[model samples]
Target: MKKNLFLTAIIIIVSIGTTKANSFKNNIYQEIKKDSARLSELDKFWTELSRTVREGDFEGYQAAYHPDAVLVIKQNRSISITEALDNWKQGFIDTKLGKKNDKVEFRLSKRIGSKTTAFETGIFYFTSTDSHGNPTEDYIHFEMLLVKRNEKWYALMENQKSEATKEEWKALE
Candidate 1:
């Protein structure tokens, strides 16, 4: 009787452990699914953004930002989306689109967080290709806060810096 009781108790303990393990596994799976969905949605926005910027589509690029967005530079000055976009559109026209040898690439270099909000770090590379196909690259590195509103991801704020030390980047973080 004692041996049988001990055996039964062991079975019960093992069952509980197994149940807990399964629960934890399930929770992880659910989290993965949730993050996967969030990534898909965010990727859609980033793809559109990259294409717009790369092609120097000023109107499309302008549309990507939320009207209420605020952009901040390393100098700590803040500006409205409209003003920023206006400045950028003019720059794009003069510098990027008209030059046949100029090719632009934009990429979301890093990101963190979830469905509603995220911190995105991106790089925009402008390359000048010679007729021989040798290319020179200039890059803009930027970080921004993005929010999903009305089922669309919009840039809510941006902070741009040039050539910061590693410690400064950590401080910014």
Candidate 2:
């Protein structure tokens, strides 16, 4: 009788342990699924941003940012996105008028965030035509802070770090 009681206790302990392990695994799986969904949404956001810049959609490009967004440059100066937009408006107008062409491409090195926010580090390649009609290209290192509001993503801050080499840009995924 004592032997049977001991055996039953061991089995119960083992069963409880197994159940706890399975519960933990399920939680981890759910978190992974949620993260994947968030990433997909972020990818869509970036794709739309690229399209706006390529098409010179000034309103659409501005819409990607929050009304109170901030722009930081090389740890030197900071300005409101509205101010930056004001400075950049002529470029958009020129592009829209076909007087100039512009294109931007981003390659991310790191992204960290939850469902509602993300901080991204990457390099951006910008190509444009100067007033003299000369083509110019630049690779800039940048960090972006984004937040999701009302199921839409918006840039909260854009930190343009410094210049990057083409090889450096190519190194990041």
Candidate 3:
């Protein structure tokens, strides 16, 4: 009788342990699914922004950014909507003077964290026209820190315009 009771107790403990482990696994799976969904959504936004810039659709770019958007351009930084717009306009003028058009080719290098907050790094290739109407290209590595607020994701901070090589970008992967 004692042997049977001991065996039953061990079986009960093992069953409970298995149940808990399964529950934990299920929870982890759910979290992974949620993160994947969020990453897809973020990717969509990133693609749209890139398209807007490449097409020189300033309105579309403005719409994607928050009113209080902050942009860091080389050694200059803008911390307000008006300032950001002004900075863009200046850059646009310079690009036009060079007879160069802007194109952004971005490859998402990394995504870290969950839906509410994430760090994303990528490469941006800028193709434009020179003053002599010759084609020119530039490459920059960009990192954007994003935050979800009011059910929307906005870039809280960005580090961009750092010249990068293919090897450096590959290292990020």
Clashes of each: 0, 0, 6
Q: Local distance difference test, per candidate?
A: 0.73, 0.92, 0.74
Query: How close is every model to the real structure, measured as TM-score?
Result: 0.75, 0.92, 0.80
Model 3 stretches with alpha carbons more than 4 Å out: 74-81, 90-100, 130-132, 170-173
**Model 2, TM vs. native:** 0.92
Candidate 1 versus the native: TM-score? 0.75
Cα deviation of 90 in candidate 1 (Å)?
A: 2.5
lDDT of 1 at 173: 40
Error of 1 at 75 (Å): 3.8
Per-residue lDDT of model 3, residues 74-141, tens digit only: 53554665576776865555643544567776777778967688888878776776566777677787
Candidate number with the higher lDDT (1 or 2): 2
Instruction: Kindly report which residue stretches of model 1 are placed more than 4 angstroms away from their true locations once superposed.
Output: 92-109, 127-137, 164-173
Best by lDDT: 2
The runs of at least 3 residues in candidate 2 whose Cα sits more than 4 Å from the true structure, single-residue gaps closed, are: 130-133
Clashes of 1: 0
